[model samples]
Target: MNEQDDDRDGGCGAGCGCGTPGREQFVSISRPSDAPSTAGAGATDRHTIEQAVIPAGTFVMGDSSGDRNAGDGEVPLHEVTLGSFSIDATSVTNDDFARFVDATGYATEAETFGFSAVFHLALAAPEEDILGQPPGTPWWFGVKGADWRHPGGRNSSLAGLGDHPVVHVSWNDVQAYCDWAGRRLPTEAEWEYAARGGLDQKKYPWGDEEPDAGGTWRANIWQGGFPGTNTLEDGYLTTAPVRTFEPNGYGLWQPIGNVWEWCADWFDPNYYRASPAANPTGPIRGGSRILRGGSYLCHISYCNRYRNSARSQNTPDSSMGNAGFRTVSR
Candidate 1:
């Protein structure tokens, strides 16, 4: 799509308020590219796909209990039915992302913008300077030079993080990669179904219990304070390897924590109330896309969207330090 068409359709475009001033205007999008495949002859061997078979059935969607503080969007938990489909067993890893980048030279929104919004604990600043940083729960700061390759910014590298879930990717970027791979982003129904791993109406992929099952770590999540103090009891302060945690019954790992995966649905909180009982696809159009799973940055003090029924939204063109995606094929 051309720049004008992209902006109109909310596809990938340059002026999405994501790029820095005076930087190159190249749009980091995941649209279909004519560029040759970068999946070298060896690339095929490096990647593996785990399938999650969702049976055709119906289940309740959204929070059964209401969040008094929640907006009107996520209301009236309703029923949704979905046909059988398969989903990736895990979030897309750095290695998988590297293949897409190699083939298309596809820069992520963060790469093109020259930085990304990173949690404060991930930043290096003097005690005094920390107080002067931009305010957002005192944890999120717009750090320049942060991307998938250099997650923590210029001084950081992905040398030891090749197995970690790829970050700094926008929904549009993930969609583009899926298209190139002859796959597609999973609809919200499909994602929730896969996330549940065949379970019905449970708070998490594993169950209602928190990841700290009897004082044992079940997934990678923020241990201490929301953005500042992370004890790292989970053995990670940031993103962990994609398969670092145990898989659910359907063999899906990190569906509740580690990183948020983009869904194909346009987010409308109350849409679930009026949604079809079978194969709901969300609203026809909206300002943002739906994101599933919570990231390591999630905390109960603030954003508790890590639950399987919990949902979040973001602009399709927006990229963040903890955003990535996986794919599903028919």
Candidate 2:
């Protein structure tokens, strides 16, 4: 089957809860703590985000959810012990990225490439003006002038989204931010460990409960429909405020869904079989880097990596409106 830009691993309208590929939902997100968080603190001459400390420990990593929705890459459940470390309470935000750009006069990969892929619905252009959509994925279009600053298109702006996680950022772009911020992206193991929020074998940060068990929309995801229509049942059409959701057990915010977060390791689907018992950094070298958590684009009809342990990847230079990252420190 030819790959389409928006084509998911499964065709449209698929659902999974038993570790199979599908969709799930939740309630109005609220911050659990009003205490000033240490998530974004920095270490002088570099930007620092308040971070939550994840103590050193071992947890069952990889797929054991028995989730019929899970993919082959997440299989072969294994134990992974990770050292305690601190991670940003949430993914890096627009204001955060703006600071990086302003301090270094940096240009993002989208700017360098002169274009990036955009969700078709986010576009307001005449149909003919769309550069193109990748084969098979008709929902994604090549929209010019769609960078981090102008996420939707040329007409979009960052005026009120300073607190939103920065998108249209590639893995390469995140590396630069880490360098300047004096922090590093979480290793794949660390990311999963942190995201689990001290839970053992749960599909989401909050446990096995369905994402939308109550009347509330827990994470920001496509509600009513996938590509064609977003019912906004979650009260957001795109990114939600990074601090919108309650913290996981470890005081980290919104670990399961929002924007896909970049990890430091290169991606390898079968790496788990040979991965280290402790602190696996991923493949020594690979074509793409890992992205964890799902984005607003995820839905039951398509991708559902929003669950814990579900993962995706992109080339080091690939940037998209749904991509972002967070940081961890030694």
Candidate 3:
């Protein structure tokens, strides 16, 4: 199917052709033990993956009249039907990822490349120099020793950040984790539906009102100028605990902020036009995969796509400071 066809239903489409460069090639990453027995632990224990029961039903998928800045790709609100399934209630955290890495010895894209791009604002020094930087988005710098474990590179550790959503993961890394855990990434439709928490066409997981409701914060997004200034008004200078913010109606945490979660579908800007209205899996074949949920770096000035309906794309091998994932099962 064409990109326009997939875009019609909130699945990744136009820019995700299968032949595109950097699409991930799946590799086996060994699974760790089941879920942690205790709640609110300093580190996430490997608990059995919890499945969210998304009852078979329909919900409005996009924006048409509201959100003036909503991209053309997210146009023409449509209906989508999904089957019942369970999803992880929280985004994968650093501890959860650490176990996976320890078990498989599987090197991540960032680990293989010896560095990953981190947002300037997330770095201690914005002007720090690094070699072989890629073009575009001057705010992105390649930091050596940066990975899921050391988010900002050397001297960084997940010690206190165990409960926080893991970052610096690529689509390939997410897939490896999913395969090992006997789970799969949610389809784009499934992700958007769960993110909405049963609300229809709301700008965010919570609702249309901006989180700064009368000067109160709702989610963990960038508060001030992006790539430069950060007011840290959200009580977080970086990633917050996965459960730091209030959960959506579906009891899902960090669905709108903290970090972007990778989804199964390949990304194509124009996939929704002719996309199937029921349980769309995205185009059958494509390159870049879809990532949902805005990251802590999200700001209205640059990338405010933290809403349930918001979407973004990434090369399968591209990992960054604000990218990670969750999983689902049938």
Candidate 4:
């Protein structure tokens, strides 16, 4: 077995509580050589992507619930106004990505790098195919042959996951998909506003109620214990179907949990301090890009970032099993 070190670009912010202090929400190795850029490759098929129109309006942005993790930059409780825009009804599914792949032949960064970070409990590949775990994040393992197609590991397949959100994709990879789909990632401000589901300053997309309110699971997340027991109380160990949960008032599905959705802005913890009042796109430049919504691995004990105003980020080239993206109308 070839043991690999966690050669990452930087440490994770304090937002995602993934057990390890200051570790990234997902592990990312060194980036491979760049693949040919594929922007503006084709026009978007409206039939393939269902969109929900978020009417133009202004709303207070950031963590109003006061449940924000320290240093997550989800504060200052600033006001933000955004123009009318349309967002994906659900995250990009495996079937959708497969169609994009079949049409573009574009290689994702994970495929280019030959591996991706997989949750240790969800490992499906043989022991021989296991690469190594990061230094502090024992819950995650760097598995060879892990990509969007093989989310669990080398032995996993997309047999019944056609409707599930595609995992193991990077910000850079989403750009290629956008080029082929003729869509762009939502700005951080836009993502927050739409995720609010027309509600103002609520803790979740469904108001202040907890995800497990009334013993009903509103989102897919770790149920039992972090990194050890899941109990599958939410009926999912890795990822649930993109459209499994009830849609928000805006008709957006599972905007707060499922998988981390990439946004079209560079991540800056202090961006909210000086964010523009209208359509604030994040920083002009930064090394890490913003990621919104939590993933299936999120738990109250470990990662409780599955809130409306919750935020996280990773390098543009990073890819992991708990991350994917949805697109906005260009």
Looking at model 4, the pairs that clash are none
Candidate 4 versus the native: TM-score? 0.91
Tell me the TM-score of each prediction against the true structure. 0.81, 0.85, 0.82, 0.91
Predicted model with the maximum lDDT: 4
Estimate every model's Cα lDDT from 0 to 1. Answer: 0.67, 0.73, 0.68, 0.80
Q: What is the C-alpha RMSD of each candidate to the true structure, in Å?
A: 8.5, 9.9, 7.4, 7.0
Using lDDT, rank the candidates from best to worst. 4, 2, 3, 1
Q: Please give the clash total of every predicted structure, in order.
A: 6, 37, 31, 0
Candidate 2 regions exceeding 4 Å error are: 1-45, 68-72, 124-129
- For model 1 the local lDDT of residue 293 reads 80
Superposition error at 15 for model 2 (Å): 18
| Cα distance off (Å), candidate 2, residue 226 | 1.3
Better of 1 and 3 by lDDT: 3
Query: How many collisions between residues are there in candidate 2?
Result: 37
RMSD of 3: 7.4
Writing each residue's lDDT as its tens digit, candidate 2 over 150-228 gives: 8888878888999999988878788888877778899988998998888988988889887788887678877876668
Residue 163 accuracy (lDDT) in model 1 = 79
Model 1 is weakest, by summed lDDT over 10 consecutive residues, at 1-10
Name model 1 segments beyond 4 Å from true. Answer: 1-47, 65-69, 124-134
In the range 119-195, model 3's lDDT, one tens digit per residue, is 65555323443433334355565676678887877657777888888888888777777766667789989998998
